[model samples]
Target: MSPADTGASTTVGARLPASPDSPTDSRMAPGGPGYRRMSLALFLAGVATFALLYSTQALLPLISGEFGVAAGEASWTVAAATGGLALFVLPMSALSERYGRRTVMTASLAVAVAVGVLVPFAPSIGALVVLRAVQGAALAGLPASATAYLAEEVRPRALVTAIGLFVAGNSVGGMSGRVITGWVAQEWGWRVAVGVIGALAVACAVAFRLLLPAPRHFTPGSLRPRVLLGTVRDHLANPLLRRLYAIGALFMTVFGGVYTVIGYRLTEQPFGLPQGVVGSIFLVYLVGTVSASTAGRLVGRLGRRGALYLAGGTTAAGLLLSLGDRLALVLLGLVLITAGFFAGHAVASSAVSRTATTGRAQASALYQSAYYVGSSAGSTVGALAFHSGGWAGTVGVGLLAVLGVVGITLCGTRAARVAARREPVPAH
Candidate 1:
């Protein structure tokens, strides 16, 4: 069944009358009371989460010069953050289950923004990486909590659209943070650029808190270690979930590696682009936003595996195109890469949510953890490759990751065919 149809079925079940003591059946839907407020609040939360998370990415070159660090060392600033998020996301999700989604999200944003404010003042690269890691760990509560919140509060029929808006905010935040840092660092410095992003995050956090309605649908979940471990084990044991998780990680590996190294490439040699211009390159993320939103339609046309193949091919093509020295070709390549990465991520993440029947929250958390781990690995590995072998090295890494995605998808296709053959024919 289609993702929306599955959601609709779940919503229909949720709407059925229950005992008076049960949680209220009313849910936020398009045109329903509190819907706009909820959407806007969560959108802002998404903006704050991402803007603060990658605030340093566009400034990596500047950071390298100021700290007297190599490309790989400076990349730790990015990698550390993503690694922290990967390590802490599941624990944060567990906290959300025990406490409350809104509460956890509010606390997460508050701590993350606070850390963001401190980021610009770090005394050294080591301090900066530590602060970024702290900020990332703090922000981990937002993703799974926000998804759970929407699933519980928003009607299933409106779930996909609502989630899409949230994801769009993420894209906007990533693009704007990089662009803003690029120009601002050119004028003021990387410190001030990051400070500006921190301030923006503060504003988003405040707006988010003010606008979000209190949760009426949330029920406290068990925090027992055994239960959590069992849920995690069950999810890990599922081959489909394992494949989806790997696909997500591989897609993000390409995206994270490329973006992390692109600034360095542009600032050097053939391109000789200014910091502001390098930052503006992130505008290609708007293409990702569009591609991600249209993923469902793509799946409708191509089916899941087919859509994955298309995304993989698109990313591979982009990686190859980016090998060229021409500025225009590089920009177009980034556009294609962003589009493919976002679409693949959307498909893989959605598949995770659909695959897990009992532990949807934990399933999503695992996928997210894997996703960020890829980001972390990509940042470190990509930068190291660039340090030794230049832009070609980074592109080579991305291409290999794209190949991994394609390989996994092919395996999924073969498994599906095998499973189909194993099924008995329908009775006459």
Candidate 2:
């Protein structure tokens, strides 16, 4: 179908089908063959990218101990990858626009797999950081391209369900990767662990290539100064997008910071947890599975703003709960945080994807770039809180970041009301 046919001249947002009548719904409609195929492909892609991206994080403590680096310095291993991913956000977004989502996402995962192999071989911390940074850059491809593919292909009626699955896959992959790699490092060594994660990513990349169908729709987008500036300005002009971006960044920032502090605190602590137990905390990510799917249902019933408010409050409450030192309380907190994060991410990401009239990948890339930037920035900064006031201070920072999301939620709700009143129903 041509852009003209789909109402691309304006933001149609995304409309999903009510029910998939056949296998084709996974492919061409919701719950049809196309969707199932793409969802599987996306699941594979998520597993591969996350396994490779976070494999280093699981081994950071070991890396620091082995290399005789301080805890703060050791974190660069993870930070380097995030920084690389951030720098390429717009470029990769443009690359997908110019080439295609299928090609770009496949290549992105492929390159990340290759880069994942090198981290285990770095002879020095400096070399590891460089490798990690390069790995981060390579990791940028999947996020923007994948999000765009979903936004474009999923029937608007089914869009929320599809996005929920993709985000769930991401959360699952991230949790599993950390646990898997951390365990492997504990049993064998960091090198072997890293190598295994890379190998898995390579395998999944191949699966993604085989499974993901060719896009039903795509349009070339330019990177020239005028074109790029216009596109950026167009997205920035959306009052809702700006607020979504802010909320996304702050949500991840606080959540990422919370996770970072918990790991370090558990490593020491009045609790004195081992790495294995620390890894087990990620098991609580199971809650995210439910929340991701539930959020989709919520969006249909609650509309956009109502869902966000629920997500924000869930996140804030979760962060507060985890502040307790009791092991049971901490695990419960992790569950709450996991559920809250997925819910918020699902709603905001879908909203961002919908808000754009064109270059949806670019829109998604910007959102994710900002999202992970928060992740990297939050996790890194949280370390300082650990150094200063310990876990309580760290929780304080995380909670404060959550407050930012609350403010964004309120602003977004108000603006959306105004826009709806003025414009009535959207073009789609």
The candidate that achieves the highest lDDT relative to the unseen native structure: 1
State every prediction's TM-score relative to the real structure. Answer: 0.92, 0.91
Please state the error at residue 121 of candidate 2 in Å.
1.2
Encode model 1's per-residue lDDT on 1-428: one tens digit a residue.
44332433122123333321134648777787899999899889878877898899999999999999988999999999989999998998888878888999999999998888889999999999999999999988988788767766776545556666777678878998999999999999999999999999999999999999998767677799998899899989989889999998898899889999999999998888999999999988899878877776787789788989999999999999999989989998998998888888877876665556555567778988999999999999999898889989999999999999999999999998998899899899
- Report the alpha-carbon TM-score of model 1 versus the true structure: 0.92
| Clash count for each candidate, listed in order shown | 0, 20
lDDT of 1 at 27: 77
Q: Could you tell me the lDDT of residue 129 within candidate 2?
A: 88
Candidate 2 off by > 4 Å: 1-27, 419-428
Report the Cα lDDT for candidate 1. 0.85
